[model samples]
Target: MSTSWRIRIMLTIHAKLVEAMLAQAHKDHPFEICGVIAGPEKSNLPLRLIPMRNAAQSETFFKFDPQEQLQVWREMEARGEEPIVIYHSHTHTPAYPSRTDVQYASQPQSHYVIVPTDPAYGEEIRSFRILDGMVTEERIRMINSYKAEWELSMEAMVA
Candidate 1:
């Protein structure tokens, strides 16, 4: 494990993004739903939600359609954006990265979010950083709007 993984970081995402993710998960219940949230490069802010089709289409696993993945990547590059957050749903299990997820985590910089759709688990969305097969849970700070959140932070800093 590296020192960077030990640092406690908060994932500040807009509430609408969260809702959209949850909705997608619910719509694809029993099967895993996966997607990525693209943001301005180096911003660490997730702004655009792009839900992807699960090529595997299995309840236990998810794999992005290769063509779709390439298209999305190209689109993000054209827009000067990066995949800041990669999200998926665990229909029957808790929101935690599995061994396969850790092994396949290609973007070490992106936040890996797991949304649980199991009725027994209640509403809990977990965020993590999967780097070199190490998974580190992160806190989420949901805000109504990015501008409002930024202004509040600026005010607090000035005070």
Candidate 2:
């Protein structure tokens, strides 16, 4: 018998971002809302929030508009950024990844966040990592604000 242990992953993001996503989810209601959070390449920091149009406009599925997705990717490349977090909402289900979500996850590095808009689910939001058809739930650490390294350095100098 083989026993395998996996390390739990944690995603640290700004509380304001979470609030913004939740607000969007609520506004969308029955339909799903999808978006990406871009950050410095390999930084794993979700700094720039970009709410995208769901081409599918579905209650149980989400597909980003191809044109908008292309534009966003191009802009991220130009800014030396990458999609660090890919998020969407569930209208009537829990904030958990569905089989379709796992099948469609293309970015292995992105933190997949799901916000449940169903009243029964309350405000529980969840994050996960979907790679190679495996879903690993991650703990979210929400901070009031996220200061970049440069900002922190500048603050130290001012102090």
Candidate 3:
């Protein structure tokens, strides 16, 4: 049997989640906030916002508190979840990862999202897939439910 399969990666986010992240970014303006939106392990569905402390606490960069990071990762493991979206904000520049950002990307599967808190670019958000030092940007679909999208895809396949 010749089993050939195609790999499909769909990146999606809820509007409410975006709003929450933007709020956090604004609240921590000029200091750069970092967080994660985790879902079940290997699931692309992002369902929670975990606002992490920026250990660096500087406007130019962010580093998750090592202690907090360890604790959060353990909690996520306990919940059978993993980081789906690892997000941070750029206070003075556009919503794009910096050189250091790309170098420090540890999650090849997670969406590396950047949100600029400058207020100059309203509602601007970008995501990229960093695999082996290469960055590929992905489109974000603001959906109400991934289940609905899944059903729609299934219906199309059946038709």
| Tens-digit lDDT track of model 3 for 35-152 | 9999876556788889999999999999999999999999999999999999999998888778889999998879999998887765588888888888888888887767865444
TM-score of each: 0.88, 0.87, 0.86
| Model 1 spans > 4 angstroms off | 1-8, 148-159
Best by lDDT: 1
lDDT of each: 0.87, 0.86, 0.83
lDDT of 1 at 43: 61
Worst 10 residues of 2 by lDDT: 1-10
Compose the digit string of candidate 2's lDDT tens values, residues 49-136.
Answer: 9999999989999999999999999999999999989999999888889999999999998999999998787778899999999999
Flag regions of model 3 displaced more than 4 Å: 1-10, 149-159
Better of 1 and 3 by TM-score: 1
In candidate 1, list every pair of residues with a backbone clash.
Answer: none
For model 3 the local lDDT of residue 148 reads 67
Q: In model 3, what is the error at residue 125, expressed in angstroms?
A: 0.8
Provide the global lDDT of candidate 2 against the true structure. 0.86
Candidate 2 global Cα RMSD = 6.3
- Sorted on TM-score, highest at the top, how do the candidates line up? 1, 2, 3
